[model samples]
Target: MNEQERMTRRRFLKACGLGLAGLSLSGYMTYLFGGTSVKDVLKSTLGGTGADGFRALENFRINSVEPTPNVQLADYRLTVDGLVANPVTWSFAELKHALTEVEQVSDFHCVEGWGIKNVRWTGVKMRELIQQVRPMQTATHVTFYSLGGVYTESLSLAEAMEEETLLAYGIYGKDLPAPQGYPLRAIIPRMFGYKGAKWVYRIEFTDHQHLGYWERYGYNVDGVTAR
Candidate 1:
């Protein structure tokens, strides 16, 4: 879809309040463009209640609007390349065993003004992956590409090295559900949700910052949450 069309769809989902309800996990392009009724979409996708009536991925019933990517854990490969001393590829098993696993309770803030609090996230710190590959001095930024192939997001090398920045694979003590970016995703707690690119499969260190999927259509490049 063209930039204008993508922006329009984004506005539509935001208006429907699905943007923060895990519709952001994958672009709801198929459902939105296929003339599915808003009522139907909401009915299928949004039926979960958490503490204080807030909804989170753990409790949210995920009804994928797009063809969910079939990712087998054994076959999935996460590649790290570009401007590094040693390019590396990791299988799901290797990643878990090789990296220092950590967990934290962080909040997910969407730009639409809704947030999920005290989210339990489990993953390896991005810095741990960076240390393994050893980025060159000229590599000032890193871009993460989703497995779905359309979505991408970038963060500065410094931001990626932060303790809270994680390449997360599980949430709430369970493997991420298919609709929630199954094998992997980035978790940038300080940034808004879009900055935490979902279904991510590739990481490339670059000399310049690459605009993310949302940022290309005028969302802030520095998507730090106001809170």
Candidate 2:
């Protein structure tokens, strides 16, 4: 899709999210296109229920609108290239044993004003993935590529090394839903959801931090939210 189409889709998505709950789309548009933020409006909507009015996403109702990639398990391979000292390629089977699989519960936040808390995710730590390959000292950032070959996101190496940043293959004890980036997805506890991209298949280390699909189209580059 073109840039104009993408923005329109995002606006429409937010409008649907708000309209479904009897919220005001115009107010939300102010938050998206204007300087007003969804968190501010949520305070009034939730009547100060929780910290920053971030509605604790307490359900496993499959609330995400992320797209899936068309990939067969046998053909799945993730590439770690670019500025890395030792670029490595791992098949899906290799990934299963790349690290000791660990499961953790984290809160999932979406930029369009919805969230899920205590979300159980299972997969390898991105840090471990990097450690196994050993990026060069010059590597300053990392770019995550999706299997769809369309979606992409970037993170500074420091941001990537933070705690609980995982490349997840399961959610709530089952394989990740295809629509929600099955095979593998990112689970970043603190940042807004968009930064935690789904269907990620490539890890390209670089000296520059490039914008992802959404960030390039006006979404917040730093998807940080109030704790």
Over the stretch 169-212, how does candidate 1's per-residue lDDT look in tens digits? Answer: 88888887777778898989888888877777899999999998
Per-model C-alpha RMSD: 13.5, 13.9
Q: Could you give me the TM-score of model 2 versus the true structure?
A: 0.70
The prediction achieving the highest TM-score against the true structure is 1
Scored by Cα lDDT, where does model 1 land?
0.79
For model 1, what is the alpha-carbon lDDT of residue 160?
Answer: 97
For all candidates, the clash counts are 0, 2
Worst 10 residues of 1 by lDDT: 47-56
Off by over 4 Å in 1: 1-55, 58-67, 225-227
What stretches of model 2 exceed 4 Å from their correct place? 1-67, 225-227
Task: Name the candidate that leads on lDDT.
Answer: 1
